[model samples]
Every structure is written in C-alpha cells, then in structure tokens.
Target: MSKVTGDAFNFSLLKRVMAYVKPYRATFVWSVLLTLLLAAIAPVRPMLVGFTLDQHILKGNYTGLVNITILMLVLLVFQTAFQYAHTLLTNKLGQSAIKDLRINVFNHITKLRLKFFDKTPIGQLITRTVSDLETIADIFSEGLIAMIGDLLQVIVITSIMFYMDWKLTLAVLVPMPLLIIATRIFQKAIKVAFQEVRVEVANLNTFLQEHISGIAIIQYFAREEQEYKKFEKINVRYRDANIRSNWYYSIFFPVVELISAMSLGLLIWYGSKTILNNPTIEPGIITTFIMFINMLFRPIRELADKFNTLQMGMVGAERVFKVLDTQEQTEDIGTLAPQKLTGNISFKHVWFSYDQDQEAAPKYVLKDISFEVASGQTVALVGATGAGKSSTINILNRFYEIQKGSIAIDGVAIKDYQLAYLRKNIATVLQDVFLFSDTIFNNITLNNPEISFDEVVDAAKKVGAHGFIERLPGGYHYNVMERGATLSAGQAQLISFIRALVYKPAILVLDEATSSVDTETELIIQNAIDKLMEDRTSIVIAHRLSTIQKADLIIVLDKGEIKEKGTHQQLLKLDGYYKRLYDLQFSSVGIAK
Candidate 1:
C-alpha cells in the first residue's frame, strides 16, 4: 500500500542495482566493449557513401566506386556481428543478475519477523520479487546498456559532423537547447506517470490475489455481483494509470521528430548560402552532414524512450531495496545448541500484547500469567473465544516476542536458545491445517530428504491415517491439490497429526486439532494423541472438553486471566468457570460416554 516516490535519475539506487551486475562483471564488460565497437562502426557507411559520391562517382572512376562499395558491405557485416554479440552478452548478464537478486529478495523475506508478514500484503511482496525484478532486467537488456551505446553514437556522429564542416554542424545543433528543455519536461512527467502506474499495478494484484483465495467464501455468501463491481473499479484505476503514461509518450515522439526536421532544414539552408559565397563546399559534404545530423538526433530521440525505461527500472530497484533494507528480522543471538530439549516450559509473570509501543495505550492479551508444565505432562488450555488460549501457545512457540516476561524451557530463557534449535523441538497442529500441493508422502516429510518413506508410513499408521491413505488411488503418493482440497477436513487433520508425529519433537502443541473430525475419527485421533503425548510436554487448546478430560492439568482462562486450574474432576467440584462451560456443553449435546 506504500507509494513509490523518487527522482527519475537516482544515482544511489543505480549504484545499488549495479552491485547486482558486478557478479557477471566479465560478461558485462564484454557487452560494453561490443556497444562501443558498434557505435564506432555505425558512422562508417554514411562516411563511405559521401566519399564515394565526391571522389569516385562524380569523377567517373568506376573502379574506385566498386572498391568503396565492397568496403561498405564489409563494414555492414562487422556491424551486424557486433550488434548480435552485444545482444547475446547483455541478455545473459541481465538474466544472471536478476536470478541472484530474486534469490536475495526471497531469502531476506524469509528472515523477516512474523510481524512483518502480519502487516504486509503477500501480493505486494510477489510484485517486488517477480514483476519488479523483470523491470530491473529491462535496465540491462533494453535500457542502461542501450542508452550507453546511444550516448557513444551521438558523440561520434557529432564529432564527425564538426570535422566535415563546423558551420553546418553549428546550424544543425541550433534546435538542441529547445530539445533538451522538452526532454527534461517529458522525463519529469513520465516519471510521475510511471510511479502511478506501478502503484495501481500493485493494488490490482493485491486485490485479485485476496479475492481469488476467498472466492469460495464470496460465492457461498452470494456476493458475486458485489465482488465483481469492486474488481471493476480496481481494474479501471489500473487502466487509467497506463493511459496517462501513454498520453505522455503520445506527445513526446512527435515533438522530437519536429525538432529533428527543423534542424535538418536549417542545415540545408546554411549549406546553400555558404556554397554560393565560397563555391568550394562539395555536394557530398552537404550530403554527409545531413546524414550526421540524422545519426545524432536519432539517438536523441531513442534516448528519450530508453531513459523512460531506465526510470521505470530505477523505480523497481528502489522498491526492492526498501524490502532488503528492512530491520524487522528475527534476532538469532542465542548460542545454545542443544540436540534435544527436556520439554519443561515455564511462563513466569508474563505481561504481553501484540502491540508493544510507548505512546499507544497498552492492550494486553495476557497479564500476570504464570504457569509451568513438567517435562512429560499434558496441559490443556480451555477458554472462551478471545480468552488468550491461542496466544499462550503462540508465545510458547515464540511466534511473537513477549513484552514483559521470561519464557524458559529446561531452566534456560527461550530467547537464550538458538531460534532454529528451539523451533525444531516444538511441533504444532492447528485446527485449520494447511497442506502444500504435493504428494501425500512429500507433504508428510515436507520435502525433507532425510525423512525416509518407511518413517513416513510408520508415522501415518500410528496416527490412524494410513488406512484411508492406502485406499486412495496412489496410497502415500496421492497428490493433494492446492491446500489439500482433494482431502476431507477430517482426513486433512489426520495428515497434519501424522506430520507432527513424524518430527518426534520434545514438545507438541494442538490447537483444536480434533474439532473438525467425526466421532469415529475423533476416537482414532484420541488414541493417537495418547501415544503421541507420552514422555513429551503437550499443550492442548480444546473446545471439546471431553477430548481433554484426562489431561494431567486443565487451566481455564477468562478475559486473558487464569480463573481456574485443576484436574477435570477437581474443577467440576470447584463449580467455577470450567464447570459452567462443561455443563452447558453437556446439556446441549450430551456428554460423550
């Protein structure tokens, strides 16, 4: 949602982008050398034609004219060869640089803290990595390298014109100051236009991505017409931004052509007047000066267009660098590298909130919360919606940092353990399980080559998912489409359980893991849960109290505070919030016997 605003020619951003080009420096150097050679060769044909006209053909020397023509043909071949080499080398250089840059952006994004993703739209990040990177490739393939060649061509042509005749050259350059002013104005306008175009493009992609992912919900609610209208508005904005950019181009090219024609006319007018007075200026010199003027202005015209390419590329580079420069990365300062944890967790005097800022009023999700789970015990968290049950689990996994608290595992602060090592010891299964669009076997192993096929089958069999998976077309190799759409909700949940079990973590966290399963599946999952929880710390957030009745301890939460703590039977005798919740559930659906 952030707008990109910067100068059209940003040297700092250019230097940063060029750093990516440095790795393929050898190829880039070859491309630049080819560009210069092409520029040097470009003027030879016109110069040769002028020489042939003044010295050979006009004097009726047939052999001399034939030799000049053959030389011109040879120069053409060399020019063609140089152009081909330049194109091939620059393209290879551009692609290699973009490949490295794209990887760097993706790597940086992975290192960013969860909070960064919480606020940033996934579509914006996609645009930064994909489309914006393509624009940067244009800088090498179509913009920067070509612009350099154009610059050299312009300089060479201008020098050749002065050598031929200074007076005519001065006359041809008379319109230059006006052309420069016009170009500057065009650059400023197009820069703003391109920025608007990029902003609208990002907005459109964000809107489309969100709507497509939630299309099922939209159709279920019968809001198709409403969603379509919203999309139309976004599409119109994107179209209008592009039209504005085209409007600038529509005016720019003709103005350049008019200036070029006027300069050519001035050159002819001055040559005619000088010829009458001196009688020494040859027609071929006039012819060659005209060709030189065209060569010079042609680059000028093309440079305007290439400069726009350069500006757009700079805009993309600026956006990409912003993401790369972000400081919202997870801190990995801990040195502790334990092979396995003892699964003892303690949250002492924890005061926490999602937002931790000095100026904002504190909105704590957990306050004065203190609890401990022994090395091998099942602790269940039961609470009403928005009662901090899920937040407690999130903190234990260290998904978000806690503001005022010390969360320790095996007597060491959670922050004192290496982040990756800490996470590897904890496995979680959420109510809404997500599976990648991969074979069931790969999904279970998460593409980890270390996890053998036998290990996966054993994990699934233990979780009671193996029977259903074997009935499928490909058994373990069945490809579950995006989000595992081919699998039922209960089946998906079972696969998630299998995934967690295969990891053999020191701690397991389940958030409403069985809330979607039927009675039969729930029983099967419960049996698996019992086996999975043995000799490991387990945390459960359960809506179905029956599923957690045998937990070693049950902690009842109300409005971010613990209101009751006991065994299920002990809590019932206490007749507190837990008992009330239990009775209400039993009265509505009867207790599962």
Candidate 2:
C-alpha cells in the first residue's frame, strides 16, 4: 500500500463532509447560540474582578464590596449554566451528524459494483468505515467546539479590551500576526505528518489481515521467517510515522505557549506604564485587562491544537469521499420489472476483454464466440486456464458486459434488464464459496427474511447439506465463522449449493462446483446438483471433462477461441480438444472403475 498524502484533502471532500451538517441545522443553530452566550458572559468575570480591586481593595469600601462580590458570584453561576447547555447542544448535533455520515458512506459502499471491491483492499475500506470515521466524529465534536468557541471568545475579549483602553488593546494584539504565521506553518507540517501516520496505520492493518488469513499456507510452506521480516518492514514505517507526528506536536505546543506568554508579558508592561502616567486609569481597569488577556490566550492556545486536529480530519474525510465518488458499474434500467424469462440463452458474436486500454493492450480475453443453450438444456464450458470459460459465464450472468455483440436471455436483450432482476433469475456456485458469519439457516437462506425456516431446510435436504447439518451440535442453528472458516472447503461449497437450491433460480451456473472436493464429497455434491438441474437451464464451467459428459452440448475452448463443440461422444469421434481434456482427467478413472 502507498502512503496517504496531504493532497487527499481536496476542496470537493470538504464540500461533501460539510453536507452532513445540513440535516442537523436546528441543533447546530441552538449550539451556536449557546456558545455565543457563553462567550458574551465570559468577560463579566474579569469586569467583576476589576470592580473588587477598585471598590473593595483600593478604596477599602466594605459596604460596596459585598454587593459587588455577590453580583460577580451570580454571573459565574450563569456562565456555568451556559457552558452546560452549550456542551449538550454541540454533543447532540455532532453525534447526529456522525450517524448521518456513517449511514451515507455505508449505503454508498453497498451500491458500488463488484469491480470496486475487486480493486480496493478490504482493510483500507474498513479503515475508512471505522477508524477514519471516528476521527471525523472527534473533529466535529471537539474540534468544532474548540474552534468556534475560541473565535467567539477572541472577539468578545477584544471588544472588552478596546472598551477599557484602545491603545493597550492594540499593543496586546501586536503579537497576533506572528501567532497566525506560526500556526499556519505548524498546520502545514502537521497535515503532512498526519497523512503519513494514516498511511502507516492502513498498511499495518492490511499486512496483519493478509498474514492472518494466509497463516495456514505460510506455516505449511515454512515461510514464517520470511513473513515476519516483511511485517517488520511495515511495522518500522508505522513507528516512524507516529514519531514524526509526535515531533510536530512537540514543537508546535512549545512555540504556541511561548507566543502566548510573550503577548501577556507585553500587555502587562504596556498597561502598567499607561496607568502610572494617567492617574485616571484605575487599578480595577488594569486588573480587568490582565484577566481578559488570560481568557483570550487560553482559547488561542486551544485553537492551535484544534486546528491541527481539523487538518488530520480533513485527510480522513478525503479518503471516505473517494469511495463515495467512485462510479457505479452500470445503471439499472429494469426498475425491478418482472420479465418472467424462459431459460433459453444466446451469446451472439461476442468479443470481450476487461482492459480499459484496449488499443495498446490489444488483448481479448474472449475472442469472437457464439453459442446457444435451449430451455432446460445443460451446456458445459471446458478449457485450460485462461481459456474464457468463466468469462463466458460471467457475461451470460450480466456480471460484465462484452465489448462487441449482444447477449439475450429468452429473446430479451440482457442490457435492458436491471442488474438485480438479472441476478435474481440466475444462481451461480463458484469454486470459491463465501458464507457469512451467521447461523446455518441464515447462510442457506442468505437471511432473506422472506424465506421461511421450513423452505430453508427443504433446500438443504435437496443439496445433501441437511444430512451433515443434522449431525452438528445445533443442527440448522449452527453458527458459521467468517467466510465459513469453521467448515471444510467442501462443506462450504455444499452450503453454497444449498443456498442456490433455496433460491431455485430459472438459470443455474456452476463454475467448478466439484473440482475441489474429495471423491465421496464430489459424489454428494454431484448428486445434489443433478437433482437441482432437472428442469433448470444449467451452464457448468469445468476442467474435468467427465463432469460435463452428460451435458447436451459441450463447447471446448482453446486460447480464447472455441476449438471444438459437440456432445462427448461426437467430440471423442472428432478427436479434438474435448477428447484430450477428457483423456487427461478421466481416462485412468475409466480403466480403474
């Protein structure tokens, strides 16, 4: 994985991130009003301190001091109440915004086509969904609170300072420009450093995930040491990224503190000199000036830290929006229309390739090919690796579109049908079967919610899965781990077959269904499949020719072109590609049996 960079934070990302706040406008407005009230009330404390200094301390007016002190206490109570309300409002608004963003990103991901999943790493996607989202929540909650409150407090303190004495106010803010420049510099460095940190974290997650999933193969091959070395390289980069982030924060805080301290010192010196020369400048006013400076600098200090966090959040926002911005594979024009298609399928003069740069690559994964399967007939596609068997199946299923020519299902153009409608009518069992981490019943029924429990069990029985499921500790209630890691590959395949059986689609596509199973398991799966295919139109993509011997038609592919097409007996008589593949797999079995 490549390192994440600061350029990921584009203007478009910010625009999208801001869009989440629109729904929570009422909550945000209340939060802002409360925050402004708190800011307006903040200056009262310093004014009260000044009153005590002049009336009680300087003049020694005890009777007046008591009233003034009580008023100050009352204002403090109001300030505390405003703070409580502000916190509640902002927290409510922030959390609601996060919920909206999370839902939007999730919904977008689900709508994306299979091709996006093929290219994007699962770990990176998970990072965007979980960790990055949490970071954005922090930015919305704490970062927004700090930034908005700081700016408002600064404005309030400045107004109060100018009212006390304009000359001293200008002097105090002499260091403001320097502070802004310094903050800008820190922000630039922090953005770059945090981007590095994000990259390292994503890389670490991907590395760990890959290694854990492949642990069995790594151990069997005795490649543990090699994998360990590889992990160390990524771990070291993560460490370095973290250290760099720490370094940025470390330098930034001290410089910001120094600037704040220097400003206060300059303000104190200038205010005292002005008061000494002009006796009308009461000691109370000086006290208030010092108090205002303190309050002002605190938020300023917080602003520096909050700004850094916001920059990091922008990086996260960019990653999430990138996924949202991806183009969906194709528009569904069918609108879930019911076509009630017959089983007949036709591939007309089809030429296909996956490459976008077709001119330079000039590589057609499937050259001109045409075939037809009549309703309820079985067509077997057999070939060596990269011979376009799976490609043909994918095209027929509308998983992809061909470069030239058309595919028609029951005389209707496949493109005219919605993806959901097309897929709903077709069931495919791939060599690699994926089962969710759910109960056996859910896995078989795919948690349709509409499919009843009895129907699921019936489907399982048809696929021979019910027999072993009954042997499990919980029978149909047995829970499968992620990707069915708890079961053997053959068992997973059986469960997949049962899932297809339950759907009972009109057209069934089996891509090497029995290729990975042992002889006994193969027989169980084959028997179940034979029963499942009794009336449905079935297309089987197989390497072992015996599996397709019963097929009404077998189309043999060689180097992206069909070299032979006929029944098993007819192909044997032709003495071509089909006969050769048949000889390789089942010739010995034929003699032994």
Candidate 3:
C-alpha cells in the first residue's frame, strides 16, 4: 500500500486536483458568483426586521411595516434562487471532474507492468479508482467550494455587524479566538484519524476480496473458522479507525457550540447594560446583533466540518497521485510494424529474477538459458515446480523484462516489435482458464466486434468445443457466470482453446493446459491440439509425460538452468534428467496407457 504524508494540508495536491476542474471553469466561476450573491443577501432580512421594529412598529405605522415586510419577502425569494443555483452548479462541477479523473486512473492502471499488480492488491486499486475518487468528488460538492461559501458568509455577516455597532461587534467576537484555536486542533487530529480510516479501509477491502475469490479453497480445506477469525480481526481494526474519527467529531462540535453560546451570553449581558445607560441605544439594535452573531458563528461551525471533508479528500488525492506517478509502467518504445512474423523464437544467455528489489542478492529464477525453435515446429518444456518453465513463457510475452541477454523472434529482438502486436501474434492458454460474466460467444471472442459469429463458431468446431457448447441451453450465447462458475473445468479449458484458435496466432502456447481435464476430455483436447499445432510454432509445458512424448524437441530444466534438450527417444537413450522424469511418471502410472 502507498503511504500518505501526515501533513494536515497539501497545497500541491490541491493545485493538481484543481487542474481536473479546469474543463468546467465556467460552471465553477458561476458557482462562486452565486456564493457571493448568497452571502450579500443573507444579512438583509435581519436589517429589515430591525428597521421595521425601530421605525414602523415603535411609531405604530401600519403602511410602513407592510412595505418593510414586502421587501424582506423579495430578499427571501432571491436568496432561495441563488442557493439552488449554487448547489446545482457545484455538484455538476464535482461530478464532471471526478469522471475525468476516474477515466485517467483506469487508463494508467492498464498501462502498468505486471510486476506492479503482483505486489499491489486488486482491492486497493479498486478502492483508489472507485471509493477514493468519490471522496474527492465530495471535496468539490461539499468541501472546497462549500468552505469558500461559508467563509464568505462569515466575512459578510461580520462586516455588517461592525458597521452597525462596533462595540457590540467586539463583544460578539471575544469568544471567536478560542473557537479558531479549537478548530485548528480538531483539524490536525481529524486529519490523522481519517488517514488511519483510509488505510484500514484498503486493508479490509484487500482481505475481503482475497477471501471471497478463494472461498472454494477455504471450504475445501475446512478452514472456515480460521478464515472467519482472520476476517474478524481486520473488521475490528476498521471499526476502531472509524470510531476514532467519530471521537474527534463528538468533542469538536460541542466545543464549537459552547463557544457560540458564550458569545451570545456576552452579547446579551453587555447590550442590556449599554441600552440601560444610554436611552438613544435602540432595543431593536440588540435584536439585530443577536441575529447577526448566529449568522456569523453558524458558518464558522459548518466550516470546521467542511475542513474534515477537505482533509480526507486530500489524502485520497495523494494516494491516487501515487499510482499515477509510478515509474514502473511498461515502456512500449518499439516502432517495428512487421506485417508477418515467421514464428521463429530464440533465447540467448537469458537471466531473470522476480525479486529485483532484493538488497542482499536477487535470486535468479532463470539463469544462462539458451534455446531456439524453428518456424512450424513443436517444442516441449518439462520441469519440476520451481524450475523456471513458466518464467520462460512470461519473458517470451515480455510481461517482465529480463535482467540479462535477449529473446528474439524471426532473428529480431522481441522488444523491437510493438507490445500489442507481439502479444497478438503469440496466443497463450494457461492451466487455469478465466471467463468473464458474459455470453459464451463473447467470452470466446472477448467481445471483439471484428470477429464475426461464424468465425467464433468455426474456431470452436475446429477445437472440438462445438459439441459441448451446442448442448448448452443458449448454445454460443449461454451466459457463463463469474469465472465461468457454471461450466466444468474441461468446459472452461475448451473455451480457452477456442479463444486462442479464433485469433489464428502464429505461435501457440499451452502451459499445462490439459492438466485439469478428465481422460475422455483430454483425448478430445489432444486431438484439437494436434490439429492446431500443424503449420504453427508451439510451446508446451506439461507434467504428464505422455502429453509431450512425440514433441520434436524436449527441454528439461532444473533449478533455473537447462539440464538437457533432445527428442524424447534420444533423451531416453541418454538416460538423462528428462529420461528420469519420464521414468518417474511412467513407471508409477504404468506408462499412461
């Protein structure tokens, strides 16, 4: 998780966030104008009441009182209109700015390299894009613009009060310094509290998303109680964080209210004495001052609350900017535009390590690896669990950069080709197949409108998936729920094969693609694989010895280095690592007949 600074306010972050609002500058300017209009109008009603009380009521003039009442009514109508416009414009500006920010975050996320996702949790990114952005929107709708309006109201109300009677204004303002100090304390304390709240929110989301996605594993191992306990601990931390934020609110608001009451008390005590001593001091003036004091202190109180919103939004902006500022993005500097690739792949002295940041020593997962496969040939990689077989495929796809040496295709470096074009030419089918919550046809084509329905159907039929797919209720249109939970493991793998075939890739890769299917289904998949392998470069990673027995070449890897490479019969004759691995499988399973 990215850490945010403890500073209560960040002007740099504010400036960056304000840039998003630049597109809606006209609406924001109009909102500010409406806020000024509202502040100016707010003090009029109290002044009218004081004038009517002193001039009309005291003199018992009915016509004069009625005229004053009509004027107050007009001010009320204008105030209401301005208030409505301000609310609407501020909300529109907030929402519009958030929309642009969300799109940019998503686009940046897609451009990031695989290593970033490997370390960062999916839920944390979701929170940044969704929940955190919404909080930022609150800064515009309820925080920044709203705070400015409150400040304007306070300033306007205070100006009017001092103009009316400077002595009473001083009396009303005596308690204000204490209010300001208390508010400053609250701001600092609540900023820290909200940062904790955001951290816990991201943690809770990460834990919940992880467990929810792996619910099957928990249930399979009967670890429900253990997992529940873990979740309970995270939930408690989230609750405690929120409670601390509430504690600040609980203490701060009442303190503000107490100071407001004290100011009112002082006004009444002093105003009564002044009126008693001087007969010229109108009673209506005291009444007007009381209204003015409420208007002034009310905005001050609301401003404290809006300050909290602003702090939380700044924290969100900081986290969001951290992602946007990441330097680990995949650099797509390749300019090659080859109309056709010959499908020849070569690796020379390749070395890689997933733990690139290790200070002591980075452990290489693949070391001094070298191999080559001609166009239209089949090569199989056989290795134990930590033997770097998958790392080879990952590097070939340029998902991760190699620490040393180079991987090339058709005598040109892999990085020389555009990233999108390189991946498009190399189709991959992993052991674990993933399908989105959409129709089967869309899942196969990945909603690519360019691939017609006939093309999808032809791909499925070629891979022997047409029989099972046609049996589905909606056939190709059948909706596979989340992760294709509705389909069997064999069925999902078949969809993956169809997806790869639809693209007609120049190179096809099967990373234990048939390991999860039953024998009957494996036979169907094997026949399809045989057909797909014809006239195309293919790479197979398999634990099952029978699957790669007929490969043109088999490479055996041990601890990140190639131990042996040859045809299966030749490797058997040498009695090397590949032969031993083949023996371990065949001797135990009676040759997988």
Top model number, TM-score:
1
Local accuracy of candidate 2 as per-residue lDDT tens digits, 269-308: 9878887888887878877877887788778877877876
Over the stretch 1-593, how does candidate 1's per-residue lDDT look in tens digits? 23334343577778888999888889999999999999998888888888989999899999999999899888888888888989999889888999999999999999887778989998899889998988899899989999999999999998888887887889999999989988888888988898888888888889888889899999999999999999999899999999999999899888988999999899889988898888876788888877887888889988988888888998888899899999887787999978778999898989878886759987999988888999999899998899999999888777778888799999999888988888878899999999999999988889878889999999988988899999999999999989999999999999999888888899999999999889899989998998888899999999776656878889999889999898888998998798888877765776652
Tens digits of per-residue lDDT for model 3, 477-527: 999999999999999999999999988889999999999999888989998
Steric clash pairs (candidate 1): none
Which whole-number lDDT from 0 to 100 does residue 310 have in model 3? Answer: 86
Q: Quick one: RMSD of model 2?
A: 2.8
**Each model's Cα RMSD:** 1.9, 2.8, 2.0
Clashes of 2: 0
Task: Tell me the spans in candidate 1 whose CA falls farther than 4 Å from its real position.
Answer: 1-8
Tell me which of candidates 1 and 3 scores higher on lDDT.
3
lDDT of 2: 0.81
Tell me each candidate's TM-score. 0.97, 0.93, 0.96
Instruction: Give lDDT per model, in order.
Output: 0.88, 0.81, 0.90
- Which 10 consecutive positions of candidate 3 have the poorest summed lDDT? 1-10
Better of 2 and 3 by lDDT: 3
